[model samples]
Target chain A: MTSLRHRIQAAAVAAALAIGALTACSGGGGGSANGPIEYWLWDSAQQPGYQKCADAFQQQNPGLKIHISQYGWDAYWSKLTAGFIADTAPDVFTDHLSKFAQYVDLKVLRPLDDLGPTSDISDGDYQQGLAELWKGQDGKRYGAPKDWDTIAIFYNNAALKAAGVDPSELQNLNWNPTDGGTFEKLVAHLTIDTKGRRGDEAGFDKAHVKTHGLASEGSGGGGWGQTQWSAFAGSAGWQATDKNPWGSRFNLDKPELQNTLSWYFGLVRKGYMPSYEEIGGANAVGTDKQIQSGTAALGLSGSWMISTFTKLTDAAGKKLDIGLAPTPIGPSGKRASMFNGLADSVTTLSKQPENAAKWVKFLSGAECQNIIGQSGVVFPARPAGTDLAIAYNKNERKLDVTPFTQQVKDKTTFLFPVTTNAADIAALMAPRFDAVYIGSSPISSLNKLNNQLNDLFKVAQ
Target chain B: MATATPTQQQASRRKAPTGYRDDTRLALLFILPALIGFAVFMIWPTLRGIYLSFTKFNLLTPPKFNGLDNYIRMVQDPVFWNALKVTLYYVVLNIGLQTVLALVIAVMMQRLTQKTWLRGIVLTPYLVSNVVAAMVFLWILDYQLGIGNTILAGLGLDRLPFLSSDTWVIPTIALINVWRHVGYTALLIFAGLQLIPETVYEAGKIDGASEVRMFRSITIPLLRPILSLVLIITVVGSFQVFDTVAIATRGGPVDSSRVLQFYIYDVAFGRFQFGYASAMSVALLAVLVVITFVQYRLTRAESSDLA
Candidate 1:
C-alpha cells in the first residue's frame, strides 16, 4: 500500500508537469494563417455600431477580417496594461484621448505617419482640439479621431412642469467667474418631492428629504473620468497640463475646483442631490438613473446619455421626457463643459499593421462618422458627422441633438489637461474626490493633493 | 555436499546485509524530487527577490540597479507607513477574535459525545472560496437594498456605513477574516484534544475533579502545542489579508482599507511602479520571517515543558 501511494503521487506530479509545459508552450500569439485581426473595445453599447463598421470593412477587403471583443472601461485598461507587459496586446484597440499620453510615453502604440494616405483624413474635419489630443509628445499622431462627448445638464421636463417652472425660460442662464448663475434658482424651481417641499423652504430637512433636485455619479480617472468636478475647473479656466496643447495639469487645489466640489457636495448636504449613503449600491446611482426615475429633476451628464436615459421608463411605466442643455456657468460668465474625445489606435505589436491602419482610417472617415452620428451615441468627431447626428436625432429619434452641436460650436467645451503621468495623477486624485464627496476631507485639501501630484510627476521626469 | 554447503553460506551472507542501508537509499530517492522543488521554487526565488528589491525593475525593460534608493524612499513614504499601521491593526484584531472564537468552538467539540456530523457542518464555510465569501459579504454590506442595512432600518436605527466609511472599513475586513477561519482553527485544536489520553481524564475524574477543573489543569496544558500552531497560522494569514480587502473595498474611502499587500498591488499593477512594489514585498517577507522564528522559539519552549 505504501509503494502504491508513492507510485500514485509520482504519476500525479508527472501529469501536472506535462499540463504546465503544454500550457506554457501553446498559450501565445501566432495562431491561424492571416485571419481576422483582433480589435478590442470597452463599450458594449457601441458594439453594434462597430459590427456595422466591421461588416463594411470586410466587404471592402475579402481576405481582411475583424475580430472584435468588448470589456468594461475599468477592466479594459488593466487588461491592456497586462497585455503590453506580456507583449500580447490586441492588434487594434480603442482608447480615450486623456489616456493617450501615458501609452504614448510607454511607446506601446505605432505612429500613424507610416500608414498609407494619411492626408486623406484632414484634421480640420474633426473637432480641432480633440483631434489634436492624440498627438504624442514627439509630435507624431498615435490615434485617429473616433467620437467626442461634452458635459450637459439633462432635465426631466415633466418634473419641471409639475414644479411650475417653464423649462424654456431657464435657457442660457448666465454667471460670471465670481457668482454661480441661475444654477441655484433652477435647482430650487425644479425640486419638488412627493411631500411638495422646495429645497429653499425653511421646513425642508436636507438630510431627510425624499427626493433631490439633481444628482451625479462621479467616476474619477482619465478614461472613466467624468465632469462631476472637472467642469468647475474648466469654468474657472484651469488647465491640467501645458506641454501638449490639450494636456491638462488639473489645478485641483485652485479656488475654482475647490468651489465647484464644495458646491456640488453641498447640494447633497442641502437635499438637492442624493446622499452618498442613499445611492450606494453595487453600481452607484448615476445621472441616468436619477433623471429616468424622476427622483431628480435635473442631472449633469453628456449627450451620449440621452440615448440611454430616453429609453428608461418610470415605475408607473410612464416614459420620461428629457431635455439637454449646456452645463451651468460657474462664477465665470463662461458656461463650461468638460470635453472628452476618443481615438482608435493600432498597437506596435499588431501582426497586420496595414490592415489595422485601414480600419482606423475608415472609422475616422466621413462615411463612418455619419453612421455614428445617426446612431446618436455621441457627436461625430468630424463636423459633417455632427450634422448627420443632429439630423438623425431630429428625424429618427425625435429628440433635440442640436443642443450638443450648439454647445460645442459655442466654445463652452473645455478639454481635460493631458500629461505623461495623467493616469497616475488621476489615480491619485480619485480617492481624494471620494473623500470630498463624503465630507470626510476638507475642500482645501485638494491643494495638498495637487502638490503631491506635481511631486510625483517631477520624480517621473 | 561440500559444494552445496559453500553456495548456501554465500547466499546467506548476501541476504544478511543490514536493512538500514537499503532504507536510507529508498528515503533519499523518495525525497530528492521534493528537495529539488524546494530549492528551485522557494530558495532561489527568495534570493532573487532580495536582490531585485534593491533594483528598479518595471518588467517592460531590463532592470537597473538603484542601490538602496527604493528602500530609502519607502522609509519616507507616508502611504507605506499608513499601510504598515493598518496591516498590524488588522493582524491583531483578526487573530485575537479568531483565536478566542476558535478555542471556544474547539472545546465545545471536544466535550461533545454525540452528533459527529455537526463538525462537518461547522467546517463547511472554511471550504468556501474567499471570492464567494467576499461577494456575499459585499451584498450584505451594500448601503442600499442590502440585507444588513435594511434590517437596521427596519429596527428603527440609522444604517451604519459598513464599507463606505473610513472608520468601519478595517473592522469589517477583520470580521470577514474571523468568520472564514474560526472553524478551521477549531478543528486543529479539536485534533489536539483527541490526542489527550483517556487515562489522564479517567485519573482526573477518579480524583473527583470537576469538568472545568479538568479542562483547566489537563486539557489546556496538553492543547498548548496545537493552539500555538493554530495561532501562528492565523497570524500569518491575517498579516497577508489581501483578497478580502481587494474584493470588498479595493482600498477605497481614502485608502482606509489599504494594507501592505494592497499597497504593493497598487504600486505594481495600478501605477506600474514594479520596483517600488518589490521593495515593499521584500519588507513584508522579512517581517513575516522574524515573527515566524520568534513563534517557533516560544512554542518550542512550551512544548518542551509539556514533554
Candidate 2:
C-alpha cells in the first residue's frame, strides 16, 4: 500500500511537469512561413469592415490566413505590450500615432522600407501627409495609413428649432477668444432654464437650468482637445508644440491657447455648458447621450462619431432629428480641424512578417480601403476611399459628411500633434487640464505645466 | 479489530526503524509541485523586480543597467509622494471602516445564528470583481442620472458629487471597497469566533454576567490574534487599491485618488518608466513590510488565549 501511494504521487508529479513543459514551449513567434499571420485592432466599429478585407486577402493568397482580434481601446495597448514581452505579439496590428513612435523606439515595429510600395499601391497613393506621418526618426516608413478622422459639430435639430435658430445660421459662424463671438450668442440662445427661459433672456437662472447649450466631454477632452477646443485654439493661431512629430518644446503657455481655453471652460461658469462637477470623473454622462436625451443642444466630437450621433434615439426609442456642421471660424479667419489617422504596422516578432506585410499592403491599398469606406463607419485614407465614404453616408445613411471632408479639401485641417513620449506628455497634462476644468486649479497652471512638459523632452534628449 | 497492548506497541516501535524516512520522503514528494509553483511565480518575480529596480526597461526592449538613477529620481518625484499620501489616506479609511463593520457583523452572527448559508450570502460582494464593483457603483453614484442621486433628490436633498468632487472621490471609492470587502473579513472573524470554547461563555453566564460584559471580557481577548491577522490582510489589500480607481476614475479630478499601486501602473504602462516604477514598488514593499512587522508586534499576534 505504501509503495502504491508513492508510485501514484510520482505519476501525478510527472504529469504536472509534462504539462508545465508543454505550456512553456508554446505561444512563441519564430519568423517562420508556416503559421497564420495574427492581426489585431482595437476598434469594434471597424471590425466588420476589416473582416471583409481579411476574407478578400485569404482568397487572393491560398493556404494563408489572417486571424483578427479586437480589444477595447483602454486594454489594447497594455495587452499588446504584454504580448510583446511574451514574444507572442500579433504579426500585424493597427497602430496609433500617439503610440507608434514609442513602439518604433523599442524596435518592436518592422520598418516597411522594403515593402513600402506594392505593385498597385505606393506611398504617394495615400492622402497627402498621412503616409509621411508613419515615418520613424530614421526616415523609414513603419506603417501604412488605413484611415483618417477630423472633428465636427453634431447638434440636436429639435433644440435649434425650439431656440428659434436656423440650421444655416451655424454654417459660417465666427468665434473669438475675448467675447466668444457669434458662437457664444448661438450657444446662449439655445440654452433654456427649468422654467422655459432662454439663457440670454431676463430672469435666467444659471443654477437649476433645464438644458445646457453645449454638453461637456467629461474631463473636457483632457489634454487632447481635438473634439473640444482644438479647432478654436488652432484657428486662433495657437500651436501645441514648436513642431509636431518631434517637437522639443511645447507652446501651451502662449496667449492664444490660454485665452481660447479660458473662454471654452468659462461656458461652464455661465451655465451654457455642464460644469465639471456636474459631469466629470467616472460617472459623467457622455456628450452624445446628453444631446440625444435633450440634456444639451449640441456637442463637438470627432467625425468618427457621425454614425453614433445620427443614430441617437430618445428614452422612448424615438429617433431624433440631428444636424452636422463645421466648426466655427476662429480669430484666424479660417476654420480648422485636427486631422488624425490610423495605420497598420508589422511587428518585428512576427512569425510571418512577409505575410503580415502583404496584409498591411492590402489594408492600405485602394481596393480594401474602398471596401472599408463603403461601410461608412470611418473615412479611408485614400482619396477615392474617402470619396466612397462620403457617397455611402449620403446615399445610405442620409448623413452628409461634406462638412468633415471639406476641411481636408480646403487645407483647413491641422495634423494631430505628434510627439515622442506621448503617453508621458498626456499624463503630465491631463490632470492639470482636469484641474482647470473642475475649477480647482487656475488656468495659469497650464503655463507651468508646459515647462514641465518641455523638461520631459529635455530629459529624453 | 483487536487493540494492541502497551508491551506489543513498544515492541513494534522498537522494530524495523519505523519507516519514518520513507514517510518523510512521501510528504516531500506530495508538496514538491506547490514548492515549484511558489518559486516560479512568486519568488522569482520578486527577485527580478528588485533587480529591475536598478535598471531601465520598457516592456518591449531589453533592460539597460542604470545604477541608482531610478531610485534617485523617485526620491525627488512629487507625484510619488502624492501617490504615497493618497494611498495612506485610502488605506486608513478603507481598513478602518472594513474592520469595524466586519467586527460588528461577526459579533452579530456569533450571538445570533451560525448558519453557513447566511455566511455565503454575506460574502457575495467579495465574489464580484473589483472592476465590476467599481463600474456598478459609478452608475449608482452618478450625481445627475444615478438612482442614488435620484433618491436624494426625492428626499429634498441636494445631489452629492460623489466621484466628481476631488474632496469626495477618495472617500466615495473607500466606501465602495468597504462594501465589497467587509463581508469576507466578517467571515474570517466569524471563523475566529468559532474557535473560542462555549465553556468560557457558560461560565460567565453561571456567574450572572451580562451579555455585554461577557463579550467584552471573554470574546474580545480570544479574538485579538485573528483580528490582527485580518488587519494585516485588509491593510495590505487597501494599500494596493488599483482596479477600482483604474476602471472608475483613472486617478482623475487632479489626482485626488491616485493610489500608490495605480501610480506605479501608470508609471510602468502609461509612461513606460519601468525602472522608476519598480523603484517605487520597492519602496512600497519596504513600507508594507515595516507596517506588517509593527502590526504584528503591536497586536501580539504570536500569542492566543484559546491556545
Candidate 3:
C-alpha cells in the first residue's frame, strides 16, 4: 500500500520540479564583452552553416565569440517562452514570421534599428516582403531577415514511372475549385489500388490503395494550410485572414476557400490522398516519410524539406529519386505558394545586447547568407544567397530548385499570416480542420469557426 | 502470519512536557528539512497557482486581477466542456480496465508464480516513459503500414484505425496508458495480498468453502482499504494524463481525445493563457479532491477488516 503512496509522492515531486524549472531564471554568466554572444536556432540542418558563420563572425570582430544552441520546431518555442519568463532567454534567437508577433506583443524583443550594425540592411536588402514581416506595429524592426522558403511538390520518379505517368505532365498540372484540374487527374493516375488498378480506372478500389496519390501534411495546418490547401486557395484569390501581419478579419468563410478545401479533402474520399485518420498517430508521419515509404506518390511540401526528400531511401537502402515541380496553376491563372521567412532577433533579456545585435546583423548580411546558401540547406534572404544555393543545388546535388525561386521571381507568393493570438486561433480552427479532413464534419462548419476566430482577433466593429 | 489486531489505544496521547522541550523538539528539528522542502516545492507553487487563477497573466507580463474572468470563460468555452467530457470518459475506461486486470494479475501471481523475476518482467512497461510507449504503439498500430494491420490483413480482416479515428483514439490511448500502468497497479495490489494470512485460506478449505467464495468473502473484504487507495490514486492519475496524449494523437481527429490536462497545457504553454490554465487546474484539483473523498467514503478505506 505504501508503494502506491510512494508513486503518488514521486509524481508530485516531478510535477513540482517541472513547474519550478519553468519559472526559475537560470541566466548564464555573460554580460562581459569577451563572452560569447548566445545564439539559438531551431533548424539542425542549418547548424553547420551557421557554425561556419559563427567562426567567421568571431574572426571578423576579434575577441567577440558566438555560442549556438539548436532545438527542434516544437521545443524551440516552449523553451524560448520559458526562457523569456525566467529571464534566461538567449541573447539572439532565430524567429519565424508566424511566431514573431507574440514576442513583439510582449515587448521581449530588442529592436534592430537601435543597433549600428543592423543599420546597413534595408527593405530592399532581403527577399520580397521579408523585411516587412519583422516590423512591429510601433514601426520598429523586431528581426533581421535571414532566410525564406516557398512551397512546391515533391514526386517519386520511380513511382510515377510504375504508374505509367509522364514526368512532363507534372509541369503543366492545373487546379480549380470547380474541378481539381489536370493535377487531380495526374494524382488519380498515380494512385494505384492493391489489385493493380489506377484510381481513374474502372473497378478501382479506393479502400485498399497500394499507394495514395498525395500524402498528408502531418497536421490540420492550423488556420492556414500553406503546403496543404493554401496554394490552391491562394491561387483561387483567397487569403487566410483578410490581411497579412495584422489582419483582424478572416476569409475562411469565403466560398473560394470552402470550395478549395472541399476539393482538396474530396481527394481523400476519391482515394487520391490518405485520409487524416490513416496518417494520424504519435508524431504523425509527415510528407517526407509518406513519400519515402512509397505510401504517397506526390507530396506538396515546403522548400525547407528539399534536402530531406532528396536523401530518402527505402528499407532495402534503395535510393528514392524525388523530382520537383511548381504547384498547380489554380483559378487565378497562376500558381501560388506561401512565402515565409526566419530572422534573428535580440532578446530584451540579453545582457550583451549590442554584441547580440552585431551577431544578428552578420547573420542577416550577404556574407553569412552566402555561406548558408552554399550549404544548400536553405535559400538565404538576400538574392546573392539565393543565387549561391541555386548554383550549389544545380552543380553539387544535381537538383533544380528553380520552382521555389521562380515563385519568388514571378511574385505569386503570399506571406504567412503574422499576427498575435496565433495559438488561440490555431487551437480554435484545428479540430474543425481535422473534422473536415476526416470527413466527419462539413466544410461549411468553418464558417462558424471563422466567426469565432475574429472574436479572438478582435475584428473591428 | 501475524494478524492485524486492533491497536485502538492512541500512542500519541502523552503530554508535551513543559512546552515541547523533549523528543518533540528533536523530532521537529529532524523533520525541519523535509517540511521546508515540501513547502517550497509543493505548497508554495500550489498557493501561487491559486493566486494566478484569479488573475490575467501571460507569463511575460505581470499578472492583473480579473475576478472570475477565467472561470467565466472556461464555463462558456466548448473546448473546455469537451475536454472535461473526454477526460471523464478516458478516466472511467482506463481505471475500469486497469483495476480489473491488475487485480486478476495480482491474484494469479499470488497463487501460481510469486517469483521476483516474474514481477520484474510484469513491471517492465511501468518503467518505460509514456513517450516511448506511445511511439512503439504508433509503429505497431499504425493504419497504413503497422504490423498490427498487417496481421489483420493476413487474416483477411479490414484494417482498424487505432490512433487516428475520433472514436478509436480515446480507447487506444487509454489502452496504452493502462498497459504502462497495470503492472505497477498489480504490484500494489499484490503487496496488499501479502498482508492476508495463509491460515485464512487453510480455514476456508477445511470449512469446505470454495476458493472463489474465500476470495470473495475474505480476500476482497480484507483488501478493501488497499483497493480504495488504488482507485483514488489511479483515478486522479488518469484524469491528469498529458504525456501520452501529447506524444500521441496531440488531441486530434476532431479533438475527440483532448483530455482535460492536455487542454490546460495547451492553454498555458501553447496559447500562453496561464491565468485561464491556472483556473482550469484549480478546478481539476477540486474535482480530484471531491472524487478522492467520495471514493474514500464509499469504500470505508479508513477502516480495515484485517483483524
For each model, chain A TM-score?
0.88, 0.91, 0.93
Candidate order (lDDT): 3, 2, 1
lDDT of 2 by residue, A106-143 (tens): 88998887653332346788888888888888888888
- What's model 3's overall lDDT? 0.84
Model 1 lDDT, residue A333, Cα = 60
Candidate 2, residue A430: the lDDT equals 82
Find the 10 residues in a row with the least total lDDT in model 1 chain A: A14-23
TM-score for candidate 1: 0.88
Question: Residue A326 lDDT in model 3?
Answer: 93
CAPRI tier for the interface of model 3: acceptable
Instruction: Report how far off residue A318 is in candidate 1 (Å).
Output: 4.7
Candidate 1 lDDT for residue A6: 29
lDDT of 3 at A76: 82
Residue-by-residue lDDT tens digits, candidate 1, A114-206: 778453556787886877777787878888889888877778888788778777765666433333457766775566644777877767666
Once model 3 is optimally superposed onto the true structure by TM-score, how far is the C-alpha of residue B188 displaced, in angstroms?
Answer: 1.1
Ranking by TM-score: 3, 2, 1
- Model 1: lDDT to the true structure: 0.72
Worst 10 residues of 2 chain B by lDDT: B38-47
Highest lDDT against the true fold, candidate = 3
Kindly report which residue stretches of model 2 are placed more than 4 angstroms away from their true locations once superposed: A1-32, A116-121, A220-223, A282-284, B1-31
